[model samples]
Target: MTTTLTRPGALAASGHPLVRPQAARHLTDEQIAELGVELDAIRDDILAKRGATDAAYIRRVIKVQRGLEFAGRGALLFGRNKAAWIAGTTMLSFAKILENMEIGHNVLHGQWDWMRDPDIHSTTWEWDFVTPARSWQHTHNDLHHRWTNVVGKDRDVGYNLLRMDADQPWKPFNLGNPLYNAMLAPVFEWGIALYDLELPEYNEGLKSKADLKRDLKAVGIKAVKQFTKDYAATPAVAMLTGSGKQALYGTLVANAVRNVWAHAVIFCGHFPDGTDTFTEENVEGETRGDWYVRQMIGSANISGSKLMHLMTGNLSHQVEHHCFPDLPSNRYAEVAVRVREICLRYGLPYTTGPLPKQVASTWAKVFKLALPGKGHFRKGKPASA
Candidate 1:
């Protein structure tokens, strides 16, 4: 997926690396402690804010935010079709992008909740449907923060078989090749149900009972059953009546698009072939902080426009994201500066190519890791010991 993106709009300029590559290593414990201070400040703000009210002043704030997002696309969005949107931005679907930034990512990271409601704890295990938020917590917090691509258990590294880096066998494949699924990523959320959230908990849950696997399996079954019911309801939406159907259809279609969209972005993050997935034995048993450093080393941050950065929720800044999971996502541009310093300090491989480069790299990772070859047969023994 190496690209010669020296053209305009590319993250490269002439000969220098885009965005000034820099990185650091061995931050004093003081640095880590400082992050805790930052968290406390954010927590205090959340405690002071009041609830969302119809007549509240913050409604104005939310409205202003919406206006910013609406004008961002430069179109009046009142049930207009794609043809109407064509009159505005030419580069991307501004509405979906706005939704991702304004609604999806914030909810995923619980930014709105963070500074408004003090009680809501944004655990990686719950909340935020878009951007595969739980997956972010697991991939960023559990895997990157805790293990950071340590291979066997880190959970971020994929690309060895047809499965996603963090996928588990759902149904039988072809005994061998069949057990592995290919690029289920794009539409995996609809079909795989709670696979994203469930896998992390199952792998990293508290010390468990004798029937832990059985309990986990029950969750998986329930997730699929619910997803299937929802999927089947999509097309039948037109059949629903009254305002009830109108609301349901609108919600259903919006979610269908966003859920699928989130998976596509996330899958390309690391499941592709060129990305490396080092096991525990290879990287050694790294400490928690080392894992954060390693995830930045292995991950690439795809560059996009300012609006693209926000609407897409700085996912384009993938490296910064995988590094700082707790920071308000809006601040990635600021933290990214320090990341550049760190990369240079450690002589680490910090990849932050443009979108084209990121996509190409991910495509390569998919084929290289997913193609079943040599003794790639499944054990065929059901989920048993």
Candidate 2:
């Protein structure tokens, strides 16, 4: 949750405060309006270009994913050679990652809404993940975006597992073994499914029993379909062709690869050094510009080549993505340059680094924050409802 280089009170060398002071009180109206205008210009420019090229890009990515998936599964089902199986599984893994990231995540974010394709829109496009699209949209798009890294508000802080912040009360089980973090990456989707259920909230009387039952039924139906597709039906079909074992193993490997990659990329975005977390008091009366500032500070960027960007769903520009979630993701890179300039203009922190550095710094925070310590940025008392 906090940044690198241990200092008693400072977050980074800049010593920038984690959450901006209450923006309405600290910022001049003119300054806030200037930021709003600059960001809007960037969004407007990207919006104007979201036509043929963008459409072609999404359609092409989907086509490649489909082709790879078919070829991969075909090899797994019909081929007996071990090398063929490995190739098939690798292809399948890439296919799943592309589907989940470039296709599923963006489409469900309404990134392609300008296409006017009803089927591909956020309202109807479900994902391959066990968490139902509607539920995920509510939790992720609505809640997570609305409360990026506000410790008590965003359920994503440590995902209700590890203690991400020093202020978060440490329970006996808070001291999880490193293996616990390791195990989570491969089965990240399952962890998300359980988190989405909000069962713990239901138990704590935060969510009603009736709503819990409804959400549970929805999750159960989606989980059944996902499990059957990867674990049962494909293997069964391959068994009829005498390649059942290979098919099953291939599917398992593919799923694990997809899950771990997604987990790693997502963790890199939020938990790394330089990213900030807020308290309820700081966000009170937050304006549009204030929200943008919060997101900018709370998200970190991973720098890499275009292929790495594609693999990360262009979340390498996490700050830009958080700023403009509904924009065609391809435009994030273009807008990122403008965003960084805006940060410099406003004297805001621009936090970014290579993917390896980002990931290592994030995991180090995960390990360091796991044990007891004075929580970073714990001064603001949580605002009342």
Candidate 3:
């Protein structure tokens, strides 16, 4: 096989937003090869584990789900109470969110093999955990990776209402109230569906709009069927079904809690008040490496407990995950050391740590931006790590 590949030429652009803040920091061809080898090995481990996903891992996943549902239910039922129990829950739901953001959504887009099998390399799998490869893959892989923060090209710039760019001002969302915006984000897991799924499906380059229309129509049918089944069975639905009363009853309780935990876990990562949320344009001129570095810095990591970071896969270490996404998250703390060295070399902030620290940092930004004359673009100035 012969291929003449060319880098996007990000480093060469002296005007790149990242060039000044970051010096000429790059992996040597050889160094990159070594890292590739390291990642390949980790993929093997992941695969082996998957092969043995046996009763134990399955049980653990189930147990994790059970706990997640419980916490989620508590949050839904006792809204404020669930928030109070934030410290009580494990990292399972949190991991699920990042997993959904990066893994589930994109893997759904069609990169499951690469995620499970480390031997292939046609598609980029390293950052697939955060950037996604499906609908998101287009933004991160084609747009963000190539344009790296460019205004129009990098689809990551919108806030559904607020422009992340200082140059533009357009209210994109109807955030009814301040508290609603703050508190409701967790339950709205559909934020992903809205941004990645809906936006593209309705607008953008819908290659064959007619084809998409047909597909959507089919999907609508499936949704209706599922809804009909649920309505016939659930107490909440307008059309309640009278099926295996015991099983139906149990499912309702289990499902309600499961979804809440799943959403809460994910909501905690980026939805907190303080994390940086900017337009793609502000950082457009930045290098991919710098944008890569910033995503880590701008986003706050919960740095949940070791078991949490471990089982949840260091979603708390969002910075590390973005810095060297391919590296096994177990090595996130270790790789974070290297990333910190790079940040120091480049004078960039290395944002990360445990959940309490993450929560504090997140809300600090929220409160800061909430204050008059404070919002930076829309995010307020960067916070200390």
Candidate 4:
């Protein structure tokens, strides 16, 4: 959406066309159109090839995740034993992570809709998170993806909490930036649930009170179901076997681990060095080519093994995911090769690094932006494919 350029130096600091003239000078209008064409071809190729193999991949993930959850919960019934507690917690953590990252997130993105399986379809899959899938799709898929890194437009820039970008006016509350992020990591799902309610929109009169109430009701109902399953029901079953306290603690720890992992993967993909933030001015009169270019520069990737990629829901290929959000997550590695080639040909930055480096860079940004100043994060350097 178009927003008026109101923040002082918003354009200049954006490092985009209006912000920094030399930043993106390599791409002319004709070149951007050509880049879009190449990217479109990649997306189309994947779409055409989506078949039994892709379907099998998601099904296998679902089966494994469900099995782990069952084993974990069964183990938790005897969680009074030290070994059982450890095993249960570990299995539960993996199960929750796999469900949220690979199954829930991708399914809700409509990546598997082509399979025509209603049970796994985006409209039906309620993820293992606090936020309702529909609310997340509205805020994440519809808004955040559409706006990417644009200041004021993408609420995810700071999740309406921390001051992630210098363009965001610092407030006394921002003094807690580092602390806030640390705390947020353990309860990221709750934070996202509240964010998905769009409270700011309600305050600004953009959403009616009735609508806010409706959203709150949805969240409340979902929260009850989640709490009942994890806390009440599981612990009650354990109580019959005399391990209620242990089961409760196990589930709590498992959820925290999943939350922290999700937080780190998401931050690395978005806040790491080299990813660009834009001003609304950059998007005005934008074309398909310009949009494609924005996704390339606005996102970053994590370089690692197949297992790391799988754990991150293939979001380690963040650049590719943003370029083609609807494409199957299993195919991101192949897509990354072509995407990197296109970036090289276009002289665009393909920002990426190992997990540790990206996590450190993103955390450094959080600490730096906590204070009030015209501080700038380091620009991203081109990464090797």
Strongest candidate by TM-score: 4
* lDDT of model 2 at position 235: 83
Candidate 3 C-alpha lDDT tens digits along 1-385: 1011123334446563422222123444344334435433543554454433333433354355457545543333222233423422323244344434334433333323434444223253332121223344544444443443344554544334323333333332322324444543543433433454444535666546775555445444544554454324232331132223433333344333434444434434544543444444335344334445445445445655666654444556655544444333344565556655655654445555556565555445434433344344334222220
For candidate 4, the TM-score is: 0.93
Error of 2 at 342 (Å): 0.9
Report the lDDT of model 3 for residue 363.
Answer: 43
Worst 10 residues of 1 by lDDT: 1-10
* Position 43, candidate 2: lDDT: 84
For model 3, the superposed segments whose C-alpha errors exceed 4 Å read 1-186, 198-208, 211-288, 310-313, 326-331, 360-374, 377-385
Give the per-residue lDDT of model 4 (tens digit) for 71-106.
999999999999999999999999999999988888
The clash tally of candidate 4 reads 2
Question: Total clashing residue pairs per candidate?
Answer: 22, 0, 26, 2
List model 1 lDDT by residue over 303-351, tens digit each.
6788657655677666776655444555667667767665565555566
Better lDDT candidate (3, 4):
4
Residue range 181-276, candidate 2, lDDT tens digits: 788999998888888888768888999989988999999999899989888988888888898999999999999999999998999998887777
lDDT of 1 at 20: 15
**In order, what lDDT does every prediction score?**
0.44, 0.80, 0.41, 0.86
Prediction 4 global C-alpha lDDT: 0.86
Candidate 1: residue 156 lDDT (0-100): 43
- CA displacement after TM-score superposition, residue 65 of candidate 1 (Å): 8.5
Error of 4 at 346 (Å): 1.0
Report the lDDT of model 1 for residue 170.
26
